[model samples]
Target: MPSASTRPVAIKIDDATRDRVKRLAEARHRTPHWLMRQAIEEYVDREEKREAFRQDTLKAWNEYQETGLHGTADEVEAWLASWGTDDESPAPEWHK
Candidate 1:
C-alpha cells in the first residue's frame, strides 16, 4: 500500500518498452514501479540541470551583448585548465 507521501501513477508504454522495463527491473532486482520512479527521478534531475545551464548561458549572452565585455577562447581555456591546480586563478579579464 502506498504511504501518505506517495500517490499511484499510471503510465502507458508500448509492449516493447514494457518488456524492456520488466527485463531491466528483473536484472536489477527491483519492481517495475521502483525502476520507473528511479528513471523519472534521474531524468528530472538531468533535465533540470540542463535547463539551468541553458538559462545561465542565455544570461551570459545578454550580459555580453549589453556590455561588449567577453573573454577569448584561449583565455577561457587557460582559466579552465587551471582548475584544481595550485595556479588556479580568477576568470580572465573581459575584453571588447
Candidate 2:
C-alpha cells in the first residue's frame, strides 16, 4: 500500500518518450513508475530552487529601488572575482 504522501498520477507521453522511459528504467533495474517518480522529484527540486532564486532577486531589486542603495559595478566585480580565495572580500556597503 502507498503511504499518505504518495498519490497516483496519470501523465500522457508520446510513444517514443514512453519507450525511452521504459528502456531507461530497465537499464537501471527499476520500474517505470519509480523512474517517473524520480524524474518528477528531480525536476521539482530544480524548479523550486530556481523559483526561490527568482523571488529573492525580485525582493532585492525592490529593496534597492526603495533605498537607492547599491554598490558600484567595479566593487561588485572585484568581490565576485575574489570568490573561493582567502582574499575574498565582504560585500560592499550600500550607497545612494
Candidate 3:
C-alpha cells in the first residue's frame, strides 16, 4: 500500500493556467500532478546550481584576496608559457 505521506493536496488554479497544464499533460501523456512535480523539481535544481556557483565565486574571491595575483604581464605570460601549452594543441577540458 502507498503511504499517506504521498497524499495529494488540493489547490486552486486559474482557468488559463489549468487549461495550459492540461494541454501540456495530454501532449506528454502525463498527469497534471506529475507535470507540476517535475516543474518544481527542475526549478529547485536550477536554484541549487545558481547557489553553488555563487558560493564558489565568493570562495575564489576570498582566496584571491589572501594571495593577490600581483604579478606583471610578462611574469604572468612566463608562468603560463611554462605550463607547456604552446600554439600547438587545444587546452585540456575541465568537465565535472
Of the candidates shown, which would achieve the greatest lDDT relative to the real structure? 1
The TM-score, computed over Cα atoms with residue i paired to residue i, of candidate 3 is 0.59
If ranked by TM-score, best first, what sequence of candidates would result? 1, 2, 3
By lDDT, the candidates rank as 1, 2, 3
Clashing pairs in 2: none
lDDT of 3 by residue, 1-96 (tens): 234688567878899999999999999999998888888778988999999999999997787687763455665566667675555333333221
Per-residue lDDT tens digits for candidate 1, residues 14-81, read 99999999999999999988999989988988999999999999999999989999899999999999
- Better candidate number, 2 or 3, judged by TM-score: 2
RMSD to the true structure for each prediction, in A, is 2.9, 2.8, 7.8
Q: Per-prediction TM-score, please?
A: 0.87, 0.83, 0.59
Ten residues in sequence with the least summed lDDT for candidate 1: 1-10
**Candidate 2 on 1-96: residue-level lDDT in tens?**
235796677999999999999999999999999999888888988999999999999999999989999999999999999999999999888799
lDDT of 1 at 22: 96
| Local accuracy by lDDT, each model | 0.92, 0.91, 0.75
lDDT of prediction 1? 0.92
For model 3, the stretches where C-alpha displacement exceeds 4 angstroms are 1-12, 70-96
Model 3, poorest ten-residue lDDT window? Answer: 87-96
